[model samples]
Target: MTPCGDTEGDENCIAAIEALFKAYGSLRYGEEVTQLEHALQCGFLAQESGAAPALILAAVLHDIGHMLHPDAAAAVAADQNDAHERLGAQALSKWFGRSVSEPVRLHVQAKRWLCLRHQDYWEQLSPQSKRTLELQGGAMTAPEADEFERLPYSREALQLRRWDDLAKRADHPTPSLSHYLGLARGLLQS
Candidate 1:
């Protein structure tokens, strides 16, 4: 994988990201859809909802840490928490600002927060999500929920989490990765 850094140019960053997706985006972590499918669906949902550019990009790339991990599918099969949220946010920080990375960082916490805040949220999750939730520490405690709520991008994270949950439909058509890559390039240029 190409290591993206602060010194890299925009094309390099985009190439690195595109390469990562191309390489590992086919792996499924107990989900019906591939990683790329989920990403495109989530990004399409965000765009349909009229989300801002940063948010749209965040929705698209939220699960990028799965690709970044050395063996994310194996980790999932082993019933381990890969902490993809942190990894994705850290990797994305090299090119994207907090508007994108923070939401990606907080998305897992948002899942935990949703479980705490909504009575039926847990029931709505897919089996894969439920498995990951257990691996991800189940739900947040009351204090943890309060702390998470206070974070700057917490609300955006929650929104992204919703899209994440819904993006797993098999054969659901959405825009290509290039579309979101275009958005990312625009964000970088701006």
Candidate 2:
């Protein structure tokens, strides 16, 4: 069971991720809001933060779960259903392992925890994100958040959240797929 499995092995996960982005980035929400644009922004943020390649890949494809399942992103926030984590993890599993999946799962939990832990965090969320957080119970009870904070992964989750926050700049410059292609080959080996 190789990462690329039977899908024209040359494509690899990096190529697969890019294909997904290229295929979907053009679909508009309101005026011209495309998932493609948002993914590049997220990737740029991860790259700027010194997130390792796997994490940068996680950042790039975190929302592909939503693209594969559109209603999930539109009608439901990851918090309410936590589908983003589960879906992303499942999608990347074919080509990625713990290094990427761990952070992907934590990213959603981190979002919920952030909302509960920091009022400012909630304030900083984008309008669409804020609305989704409400649907996901952004205001988790103190006890619940405390329990989440107690998880061994809480720190990693928080770090992922910080990077997630940092990764939202629409104009951030991300390297082209060719740059990440080399990085991905080296990372899968590591």
TM-score, per-candidate, Cα-based? 0.92, 0.75
lDDT tens digits, residues 1-190, model 1?
3344343677788998899888878877455888788899899999999999999999999988887888866764564688989999988877788999999999999999999999899999987788889988999999999999899999999999999898888898898999899998877632
Give all candidate RMSDs, comma-separated. Answer: 2.2, 3.9
| List of clashing residue pairs for candidate 2 | 25-36, 78-82
lDDT of 1 at 21: 87
Error of 1 at 37 (Å): 0.1
Model 1's number of clashes is: 0
lDDT by residue (tens digit), candidate 2, 1-190: 2356444653566676666656665654222345655565666677877877777776666666765565644433333444667777777666766776677766777888888778788888776667666666667688888888777546655776676565555444667656655665555522
Residue pairs with backbone atoms closer than 3 Å in model 1 (clashes): none
